[model samples]
Target: MKKLSIVTLLLIVSASLFAQGVPEDVAASAASRPAAIVASTSWTAAFADLGGLDDVPFIAPANLIHPPEYEIIVGDVLKINNADYFIYAGYERMMQSMGSSIKKDEASMIKINTNNSIENVREQASLIAAVMGTQAESSKRVAQYVQVVEDGARKVREQGLDQLKVYCHSMQVFLAKDLGLSVAGTFGPGPVTAAQIAEVAKGGYDLIIDNIHNPIAKPFLEVSPTTKVVVWRNFPDRGGRDSLAEMVGENIEVLLQ
Candidate 1:
């Protein structure tokens, strides 16, 4: 009778375990599932990468002169619709047109200022990391970003390029200043004005740091042909978190040249 009672107890224990509904294979699969992430442009994707995301697909082409102006397409809509998070800058035309349609509760849509300046990049990365629950990963990458900018600044000071007077574009002023260059005056996201042109002619600028996406250096150059113009880009040609740092380094190299 004791043996029979032991067998009965074993059966009851097994039944209890079955009733709990925990399966090893199913639990493992759920834990391992990947998050779906999408971004409006490569710039935003890079920020997401800095935030500790392994994979992020961007909608706008990186080659665009002005990525924020890109129009959203059917595929882009679908991608954002199905993604777990959609990251973007609020300035994008896509966001202006379709932002209202997005169901906020259904999917996370984040808007962050996209700039490669040391402070902006660090702050944005930290903010993004918090949202994604990847603060540990972001802290490491943010350190790398800071190092890259500081190294570039050190290189500039070493080469004596910081002493040269620069006429910088409004959009690229942050980077120009960060590299420790002497910016005498700033120009436009629009056409160089007659007043601005007059100022440039007399400013005796050594270099004109123009925006690669929307160059407005011709007027400044027309007035002062001797002033060398080095075009710098805010957007990266390739997609990756490191691309932002690479872009900044490349800009410094061009300035040095």
Candidate 2:
């Protein structure tokens, strides 16, 4: 009998055009980390880079049952209500309720309409490591990609963010937020209407952070010629960021440059 990988028991795929690859450094770094039970798709790449599950576990959103009732399992260290979930394999399991709106107190809140920051990335990575139980190996990878993130923010800031009115796709929203850019508007991780695109262009947005994995870029680009577009790799573009931190950090660098 095939052992049912618990992580994949009852979740549905949100769909991925291309699943980002883990960097060779990340693959090697992930060798000693234990397998954790993760509940959010956003955190999957981080875990993959961290070497959480060798088999590539399913990335599923939380089970929404009984009108906002969260069904949590024994080993599920984290559960998602509205925000990101980083479920590591060991230590005491904990759940962080991601608020619908943005705020500072929360852990890693990466949402479409919400304002997620670079700190969220660092927090997410550290929390994942903490959940894995303290070990020489586990602790070794904590804060691994934080420097890169900080560096990216510094670089973007140095380039200056003023005069950059932007519209972003939902997948790239968190990245946009982390860059601390001037975001005039946002749209889907789902289908968006042509009228909506036209409305955004009319708002005088000069930039669009497009997720290459999603369809948001092309149509929106077609909407306005003056609206410059920057591509974001939703998954492992080169599979070499080593960690989510590195991937995100590098992505921000590309977008700003």
Q: TM-scores across all candidates?
A: 0.85, 0.53
Among the numbered candidates, top TM-score falls to 1
Q: Compose the digit string of candidate 1's lDDT tens values, residues 1-257.
A: 96455445544543444356648996787568876789888888888878877658899999988988886654566677656688888888876655444434533877788888888988888888888899999888878878888898999999988999888999999988888999988999999889999988886788899998999889887788888899998888888768777887898889878
lDDT of residue 102 for candidate 2: 17
Residue 157 lDDT (model 1) = 95
Q: Model 1: which ten-residue window has the lowest total lDDT?
A: 98-107
Q: lDDT tens digits, residues 1-257, model 2?
A: 22233323322111121134558997776666554333333344445334332223323332221111233342332223211333332211122322211122234432221113445544544445454443343334434555565566677688776458888887677667656677777887678887777786675887888766565567776668877788766544332235455556667767777
- lDDT winner: 1
Looking at model 1, residue 158 earns an lDDT score of: 96
Model 2 ranges with Cα > 4 A deviation: 1-45, 48-117, 135-142, 237-241
Error at 40, model 1, angstroms: 0.9
The deviation in Å at residue 238 for candidate 1 is 1.1
RMSD (CA, angstroms), candidate 1: 15.0
The lDDT, on a scale of 0 to 1, for candidate 1 is: 0.81
**Model 2 poorest 10 in a row by lDDT:** 9-18
